[model samples]
Target: MPPRRLLLRGVLTAALVAVVSPFVHVIDFFYRREAEGVKRQKIANMRDLTPGGFIYFSYPQTGDPKIDNDPFRQFVLIMTEDGQLRVYSRVCVHLWCLPSYIQTRRQLICPCHGSIYREEDGVAIEGPAAYQSYPTNALPMGKIEVDGNGDIWMVGVDGRIGYGREWHNIKPDELVRRV
Candidate 1:
């Protein structure tokens, strides 16, 4: 190779690295940093949720109107038989399609590719999904509290009032009683 050509190639490579490194660092920084200024809203009281049942709620903490702007705002709350409560994002790991609960199967089934997730822990039971589970956003359950009136309050991951039934809207009355 000619010396001039080699020198020009080296310079171009160095320039590309210099231009790309900062952007990569910035992306990494954002990914590593925790979401700030999030608001909380309580969607349901512990008493309201029956064991072995699940509640569907929206992200940015249920009911918050601001969550409507989030393209990825879907979530579910599951109350296990052991009284443990967990929240999960509804996006399927296989192809990022939204999954719906299959009542007959008692699991969340991704319609796009037949992926099944355990309602209890969001573990992938079967299908084309490579990940063992769905992705979950940070939901601070510790701040959830109920008032004397039995109303639920929760702090949402996003900085907004957790409001609305469209996301986490399953009411206790609507669920089929577990035998």
Candidate 2:
């Protein structure tokens, strides 16, 4: 084989490898990270939510619209009949539609298909949805602690309100810096 032809072939091989290697690494990295866990968001306080009221907020970490595009939103606030705060993700497991808080029905109703979720525990109580409920994907229940000032903080992924402890414990001030 000619020296020039050999050199050209080597160069082409190196270029091809260089381009493909990064893509492969990126794909692998994303999958691996996802499998381990995804950091969705952090909330400063339960006071940010009103009793029987719900609000849509962004995670800010990935800049993915919390409730609009992705499967889940940053948080959902539902003040239970007992007056305790209930926070969870807004994503519906059936078809990813953002469920609305139906005060009359006393549950989160998916406007798309009428899938009803129990606001108390995010369990699917009624409707066409087959799944038990939508996962939290972040914000552990125990981490939702209130300081002496009555400010609350939430941390973790795939957790429910008032379930357990052990959260990422992100401070409100530090949260702003991270974002």
Candidate 3:
């Protein structure tokens, strides 16, 4: 190969690698992360949330939200149309961007790509998830059960915890039945 051509190829390869490296890290961070001390955190009471209501809390988050947004543990608890209380993953299936509830439309809209999801069903209605490129369009929800104390206890996650993994990680001390 000519000297000029070889230099150009080397430079292009280096530049391409630099551009793609950050994207690879971003995707890895989204798809996979340490479960980070999986615990059934008590965020709110059943009466605190109205029917067809939503609330945000970061489980596994000890830092101040004003300082940093911990993407992993941010979750949304949704009161369904039939009065079932469920805590669903706020991460969008397409890009893993945090979605917020749109009060007027009563839908969860992804700020990243305008992905719309039915807050009740956790099903993707529009945007990148409409075509269903990901494994499951429906967001993974953690099971919230009313314990003997009448407080909402997040029992286990729907997807990974219920699939093949056991709930052994939840220590006995981690569970506090206080409202």
The model with the greatest lDDT is: 3
Off by over 4 Å in 1: 1-37, 61-71, 130-179
lDDT of 2 by residue, 12-72 (tens): 9999999888776665755535322254344545566556665554332354354234544
Worst 10 residues of 1 by lDDT: 157-166
C-alpha lDDT score of every prediction, in listed order: 0.54, 0.52, 0.64
lDDT of 3 by residue, 18-117 (tens): 9888886676666434353355656677787777787887664556784226665667877766666666667777777888877567778989998887
- Sort by lDDT, best first: what order? 3, 1, 2
Please tell me which predicted candidate would have the highest TM-score against the true structure: 3
Candidate 3 clashes between residue pairs 3 or more apart in a chain or in different chains: none
- Give the distance in Å from residue 13's predicted Cα in candidate 2 to where it truly belongs: 29
Q: Write the per-residue lDDT of candidate 1 for residues 16-118, one digit (tens) a residue.
A: 9998887766656655132221455556766778777767766454345776435356666766666655555566655667777665566778788887776
Candidate 3 structure lDDT: 0.64
Clashing pairs in 2: 66-73, 137-158, 138-157, 138-158, 139-156
What candidate 3 gets wrong by more than 4 Å, as runs, is 1-37, 62-68, 160-179
